[model samples]
Target chain A: MFKLIKQLTSLVAVIAVLFAFTTESMAAKKSKTLKNTQKKGFVRCGVSQGLPGFSNADAAGNWTGVDVDVCRAVAAAVLGDANKVKFTPLSAKERFTALTSGEIDILSRNTTWTLSRDADIGLTFVGVNFYDGQGFMVRKSSGITSTSQFKDGTSACTNIGTTTELNMRDFFNSKGISYEPVAFEKADEVVAAYDAGRCDTYTTDKSGLAAQRTKLSNPDDHIVLPETISKEPLGPVVRQGDSVWEDIVRWSLNVMIEAEEYGVNSANADAMKTSENPAIKRLVGAEGELGAAFGLDNEWSLRIIKQVGNYGESYKRNIADTGILPDRGPNELWTKGGILYVPPAR
Target chain B: MNFKLNKIIPQLVTLLVVVLIFGFFAFNAQINMDNRGIEFGFGFLTQESSFDVQFSLIDYDGSHSYARAYLVGLLNTLLVAFIGIIISTILGVIVGIARLSPNYLIERTAAVYVEFFRNVPLLLQIFFWYFAALRALPLPQDSEPILGFSYLTIKGLYTPSFVWENLNIFFYSIIAAIISIVVIKNYAKKLQENQGKQLPVFSISIGLLIILPLLTFLTGGVSLDFEIPVLKQLSTTGFIYEGGLSIPPELIALTLALSLYTATFIAECVRAGIQGISKGQKEAAASIGLTPNQILKLVIMPQALRIIIPPTTNQYLNLTKNSSLAAAIAYPDLVLVFAGTALMQTGRAIEIVSITMLTYLSISLSISLLMNWYNKKIAIKEK
Candidate 1:
């Protein structure tokens, strides 16, 4: 019997070793995402399954949104065509693994850049595209206009693994009010639960709240509370140990912002190339070695602007145009009374 | 000698190949982790989880360790499985017997039930219960109390919980009762075997179970108090039940879906077991002047159980595994709390997922081991 037990233990050890091997083999080879993506002629970008104005699809299966446009801009910069990108819709639970495991070259989901996620998760946050904060949405009929009115024992629903859950706890704990959280794995589940009145309030990023409110049966019945609890710098992410790939994704996002800062959008990008303003000239890639530094052509920023438009244009087209939330608020350019400031292309 | 040598050579080659494959994988994983600069360790288990579970059977909060969070998830999973198993077993037995009923309506009803629940996917059923049916229930302020103590509302089902004093003594009394009953049962069996005189063991055991537990409340310094749920208003419109046990709607939906789906398969197992009993055994017991009840109790049930147990145990294990689908509806089961939330929080995917899988594997193996032992114990001894 002891001998049989010993053999059984060895068998289990063998099986564990086999599983470890299989999973490792399943992972895409390390640090070759950039080369592989270029060779494949399309960028595999991960986005949320469906969060309107962030990363969502229409009935015809055409993907469009802010996150989708980021991927498009990256594709245009790297491959010279915005359409040379494939969007893999990922849930919050699988987004990081999907990126680290090489299933997707870039994760453009509306993911927050937390310190632990940056340092510990074998991933790097490229840059923030949308400056957001956690907030709450409650029913208008509840007679509660502000978050302070959410007395002790208030129930709120939010996604489980996002910063929203932790922020909710922090907001309530600091206020010394006890609350119950009805968390779900999916964003849609949280929304559905809140719509069904399982929770008195729905909490997520304010942008997420705006996008999700449009899905509710009676959108007008809900009101977003006027308190932003935690700062959420939502942005694109890439795997760690791949500085080349990280720089490409980061600069792709920055170039769009810099173009917007210089008032050089897609419609006027070619026209702006003639301007002698050195900043505009450099941003349009008319006279600078900025593109070569990132291993792209001199006209990389021009391709990004020409194909996917500037950051503001992408926001206005996908987000503001959709009327999910017309006011860009903090997502606007720095000179235009918002905090969107990108460093010089030089 | 030649045959044995040939066999040993092939076996040795296979073992070498397996070892080589494992070594290759371990080396690759090491290189992969090194490349990513991600440390591989189980040290995270002792760190503060800093994540709250929506529903847990134990006292848990954000301050507890991840190990504690895992325990909460495991306990919640076991709680759901335990309740599901008991309810499904009872329902399955009734439905199984009803399917064999002489009444056409009864048998048809049972058949329809089995077909309906068995055909629908469990995930969809959970969604239907949680998202649609439970959502349609009245809000807390509008809901009428059930039995003047509990409220079933869209938020959750609020019921009274008992506050017990000296609960350990009560538990000890119950254990004592069970021990004494076992002793008496053995003594009665010995008497029956020796003198052919039967004792009323069933009644005596039931009496001991009830009386001893009651005796704890009377003289063992045990007291119990009921804390009923009370409605409290948060805002003008929002009302909630306070000061009692609140069973979250997620658990209700998960348990309901799991049992309803599994009971169909269990019902089929039971039906097949009973039908496998031949008519000869029944007729023989009846010809020996035994009543119908006696024939069923003495001859058919024992035979039927031997056929019923193994497969039914498999169904129970499947139900436990299917409880992992609780992640879909956010029931905070082992999968949702540990594998889903904790893995997302820590990003230690390999370690967390391996732990979760091993936990389930151990559960399955232990249950199967117990069932095997029981099967062996009840196997008929050959002459």
Candidate 2:
């Protein structure tokens, strides 16, 4: 009886081990099955929740921002209507999980594309939409002039799934300063900590610091440091191994940048359809197979540029020239000496 | 034989059904994983993790393997769990005694505390502490020095870092005290049993504990020092404190919420424990000429602990498991560091998540196992 019971227990343990091994294989398999099911209709796009310039929903629940425009451009290319895309709002912690879990088709959130993220984390960054860098925001009364003056001290903030925390450490360490990081889980908490004098300085992507500074009680009392400490090439990311879907996302961004370079706004895109310029002609679907390469319609690029406007238009309307009025410094087209460049369509 | 067969046949059928279904799943999974480019193995655990953690109880970096990251996360989780359990136990006992106090105000105050914290969701409470309450703290530079050397800022509480020399000798001294206490307890018990005379075992134990540890400092060359935090300026007005060890805000919020929330349940267990002893037992002890302290130590506590321990152990287990909610606050606990960031990095979601769940399960199981053994040892014997 003792030997039988021992055998039974070992068998049960083996079964449990097998059960666990199967579950993971099941998750990977299920993801592939989902790819087939998600071939048509509206593509689900994961976006940021209420970041003013990048991705924010309106009072009417309409999504609008530079990131939002990227998703809509993809939707226009794939499903014909720019509005067909579903915008699933995600927090910084939830964004990557939602994408990898196949809860969303495209993640157009203002995510930074880093080496670890691109190579180590199993996600492919399509392209850069916003070039950002880490900066510090401090109250004017603090008399802090630059990041170098901060020294080894306290910082009030939270960061996404990357080396922002490690970067902060390195930045201070390089200067031989030791700091106590008062990191929180959300942007709102970071702001509150700063406002309530919990920490003397708030650090984040320069764009986020700018957006947060505007919400301060005395906005003028704060200064964004002139020093841009870290390179933050913010862009959209997708799950790796899906090249077909990757091309659609990649080209959707490319069309926007190309549109901006060709001066093709939503209003002028329709009239410029018959233009003699080869690049504009190709973009408007009058001269090239750019749309066909992505399994999209010939007028896919046209509809995107016409419906959502160009990259420059999207930026100005949402973040820059609009109420936020974020300065378009390096975000200008490559032809205009800025780094917002796209590869040639041909 | 026929009657036994009727019972045995159904059990056999049910077992067969379970096995078959499990087999089918296993077979299908083997095929599916093979179809994809993904390979199933634990080899990835030893490969370089190439990811950094913010707060770790153990040394770790990107250069470490996934196994090392797991260790870092596990240690942090255990550290938080141990700290929370200790704090909650002390608070619980006090509140539990206060509830039964003759003073109406103290009784009502303890009751109010129990109701306020126990009724709220743990996650929301963690958020409120981390997001709203802790956020109101002063910046490191602007922070007022606490006890002359420590700084409590919005970033986290900073205390003077303890630099200990010859720590092993100090530790050995404490171990020696513990061994002496056990030996004293046994001798006292034997003396009571054989001669019907009891030694003041508690006082003797306390004396040994203090003297042995003091001897370590005097003769063992054990020494300690503190590194205090100082304020420094960065960029125009940015002020920060440097030098001292900083406890990140997440750890603070987690401990505060976990302890406060679990204390209520523990208090209830304590109250139930003391209330379980019959009034007749207490009266009989007093009639027998036993003092109040003697009655408690000899009669009341023995019975009360029988009722208290099982439930208290369950609460401890619950607290350990719930510490996984550290993921929500980015505390880099086991689930957050391993199942979260590492899973994203390796794309081995299956392995990472299972390891996380199993880690929590084992902790819960081990505590339960210990509790079961204690319960068995203390169970009432019947003739």
Candidate 3:
């Protein structure tokens, strides 16, 4: 009996070692989501259903926007082509689940970075691409020029599953106002209801209000009230647990901002590889091995810059050119009296 | 022993495989969730929801917990289902009976309604009613009162809210009337069976039902009043009716679409049930000196109900499940408020989804149980 017990113990030890070896090899093959993306040859990206100047698709099925450019930058870095991205249009309620469930590799849908979302959910916000604030839009005929003019029994329309709902309550509760919240699951329905006079005002991120304002029957008739209710830092997000993939997305966005700061546009990116500034050379993949960390060629950042352009170019082409919040507001560089700043990529 | 082993071993192996498959899936999900740092638990239900809803049956606000918000959504869903069931059952019976009518126009019309409504998808019907039909209603300021003080407008149907004094006394009076009517009905049945006597039970029951509730106003200390809606303007073009029980246009559209859609199926069930009753049963009842009404009520209806209850129960379950589409039109039903909004807020996908599935399963099961019990009560006894 003792001899049999000893043999069984030996067998258990051998099995444990075999299991350890299997996991160790498997971990290398499946270190994260990067291997899957590389094998698939396209970056799976999640975007909003349709928010013009952000992630809306054109009549020809081409998607272009600052938010779309983020995923394009990632695609260029990892897959060596900016256009190698398949966009999945998601609702406000579905974006996070789509990302965390491996349905999409990157979620660049103008999602706000909130404490609960960043820390609690299985998601990581890469960085902010747009700085927004919640505001109310009322018809010009109402003569309600400001949020202070909103009266009791006023009905507000908004999308559900957004921070806008919570902020609207805060704005009302703080001001001691009793308002009706007509929350819809989709942005289009909210706009429709608000347009039909079912709601006294519409509320969302100010940028969203502007983009959606263009869809109204008479765009000039509705006016967004000048009151910033809540700070909304919108950005791209990725699934947690894949630090390599997370860093690749984070630095891809960072590289775009850094290029813009150094006055490097897509037209001048390839030529600037032989620049005097070490920072510029490093950005254009002329000086350092920055791409080694993400298991890619040294030209990853350069490809991102050459294909998707810099932060300023993305903003100008997608947002300013489209006539949606053309000013850029606080999204400009820190040197230009704005808050757009990122760490140096050494 | 060998025969038993042949059967039991295979069964055991099949059960083992099923359990192993389920266990593997659960284990894989747990590992993935753990790796991603997503804690799986129901602790979030007790946290503050901090979001406002458009309409609620009970008191609710941002200050309430997540559990309360779930309750609000559940109540709204139940409310729609309850109202839809009642309206559909009434319309279904009429259409079912009309289909059997000798007049070609009546039968054709019923058939057309059933075919058109049942064939067209329910989601599109809901969207049409909410976005197009209700969208055509006038704004509050432009609304003209329909049926006296009630106003039908884009906002909602603004009807006078009933305010009762000593409402409990009124309910107690109603209970007393119902109990006495049941007693009288049983006694009258016994009298007819034994002595060939008859009583005007229908008239007596109706009189008792009306007079008891009415008597509460004079002697039982029950009084009632109506608070009529008044139109008020919020802005130059924004207006709403105040001081009444306002039925939201969302609820109106959802109820209208659900009843119209489900009534088609229920109508088919009813028609099938009535047709299942044999002509011999009707002839036998007529030969026994029974009137047409008596033949239908005593012979045809009792037999027909056995078939009707089971299928009608399925329709009820379908209607309840279909009501989840209320999320599309902003009706604040279970899917919208709890599964949609609450799931987004908490990010508890696994937990919230499971709870929602269980809730729906329980509702369907309860309906099935009630119908099955009733079916058994009316089933033919083998003895």
Candidate 4:
């Protein structure tokens, strides 16, 4: 009996010791995601499962979109290699949880920077990359030119748990027009339902409309209405309480925008390093100790521009040139009548 | 004494280990949540949901609380389960009996049905119904009226609903009729047992049920008006039905898949129960010179039902739990509305998941308890 008791006590002690060691190590690892990411030699980026011109994969499994560019830019800035990124495709419903649970280091999934998501979900939105607004798409044969022409009992299909649903309700109620919202969890379902005539209209971001329109059987049959209902400043996101990691992601995006503002394209980025412009010198790490502030190398911005190009190049190549959404209404640099402005790198 | 000590000590140590592991998990979760600065509470249940459900049984809007949204989801789930249970039972009994038929075609047909539906995954079946089959339906403007009153469109099935007047008085009449019938049935049963006298209790009960409700319509000012659906054009091409009850295609697809899938299992259970009965029992009934109907009602069925019911009740419970698959096709059941959308909106993973789990657990427990009571009532007594 004494032997059994001693053995049991020793087993319990051994397990307790192991548990304590694991918990202690986990606590130590939790505080330094940047270091862990560096050690892993890749940044795990959470992206949308498939949204063309935003974050979509091709037949060859190569991910390329505006959101995908943000991930590559971050990888270029942090690891000095644009290919040092692993994209984990996530649905809108699981995006925040995945980031908060440390399943992914950054969520560049074209997620909206909503107040509740920022304040309540333990996530921090870096900055807006795509300034979009919710719009409606209807068949051209419907003869509904504007949103005002939508009468009572019009049914609209949209994705559930998105700002689109709330915007649809608010738009109809504010206009005194009663409409039914047929919501689905997945984006593909919404498109399928709309195509099947299960709904009279479809509601989503204007960019989403353009991207998803390509999937429709007759893309030319649909028209996006002119009225923009809600502002969706889609941006990258990071877990809260890690100011260092948050700054790394935020500045990586800002570098791209600033690169465009400084007239720095991928073609001229290497030659522009020797230019006499103070802001250009600071951006390319030819002057100043700005990179030390975010614990990155001095040539972080230069690597980003060289690997992923400026914001204008990414937007044009992935969005405009692809004919998914050719309009760059408000995404151009602030100097050229748009809102793509960022703080100076100093 | 040593043997007893050994057993008790090991059990106590195992209990301590389980408790310690649970405590360790709770402690880690708390620390992790604290580190992330996420507050844990159920206070958000009373907050405005600010999210609209496409199809809800109750009067719900975005202004309602999350608690109310939960109720709407719970009610929708219960509705699917209730409808699925009724349809599956009827189909199951028919197919089960058909499988035992002497006719070759009927037996093969029953076998084919069981083999087909039972092998396919429920989620895929739901997808096939919601996406492929229902999508083939016509638009509202192009839809042909069924029986000149209802319309079936890709949007939904619009059926004529009754606008009832004096509904409470009609309900009271029904209750009164049921009570009187029950009293009469007890007296008749006593008369037969004590004096060998019988009464037409079944016919009398049916007569009361119909007459009581009919009398309310005539004398109590109870009226019902049918409102048929009418197509209204919003634009050149947009059309929708007005003034009727619209059953969304999600509900139809969900219930159809659930019932068809569950009926296969129930049919197998019924087949097993019937086959378990001995041929001697049938011959023994014939020897007593009883009629075919009497032998079936008093001998075979009563015994077969004793075996059939327990497994059938298990299938009913399975059907209820499987209704969670409604989330896949966006039917807005408890799992979709409360767990999927609400959890995403609130970002309270622990609270929302636990509540959803507990709700399903309670539903399953209550149903099993009811089935146990029914099984006890139908169980044979040995004297």
lDDT of 2 by residue, A1-346 (tens): 9999999999999999999876543322444423442455677889986788888888999988899889888888777789988889986767876776668877888788877667654578999999888888887887777776665444545553444665675677678755545444466666765776656678888888888787777889888889987888889888777776777788889988998888888999888988989989999998877765554568989999888889988998889865564678788888898898889776
User: Which tens-of-lDDT digit does each residue in B288-347 have in candidate 4?
Assistant: 998887887889888888899999988999999999988767788998888877888889
Provide backbone clash counts, one per model.
Answer: 0, 19, 0, 0
Highest TM-score among the candidates is held by which one?
3
Sort order, TM-score high to low: 3, 4, 1, 2
Off by over 4 Å in 2: A1-40, A114-122, A153-156, A166-184, A194-201, A215-218, A240-242, A286-296, A322-325, A344-346, B1-52, B61-63, B139-151, B161-169, B215-246, B328-330
Docking class of 1: medium
- For residues B1-383, what per-residue lDDT tens digits would candidate 3 score against the true structure? 99999989999999999999999989998998998899989999999999999899999999999999999999999999999999999999899989988999999999999999999999999999998987799989999999899999888889999999999999999999999999999999999999989999999999999999999899988999999998887777778889979998999999999999999999999899999998899999999999999998999998898888889999999999999999888999989999989999999998998999999999889888988998999987889
Chain A of candidate 4 gets a TM-score of 0.91
Candidate 1 positional error at A99, Å: 0.8
- Give TM per candidate: 0.93, 0.84, 0.95, 0.93
- Which one wins by TM-score: 2 or 3? 3
Q: Tell me the whole-model lDDT of each prediction, alpha carbons only.
A: 0.89, 0.80, 0.92, 0.90
A207 Cα displacement, candidate 4 (Å): 0.9
Best by lDDT: 3
Clash list (residue pairs), candidate 3:
none
Tens-place lDDT per residue, model 4, A175-252, is 988778777878998898899888889999999999999999999999999989999999999998998888888988
lDDT value, residue A222 of candidate 3: 94
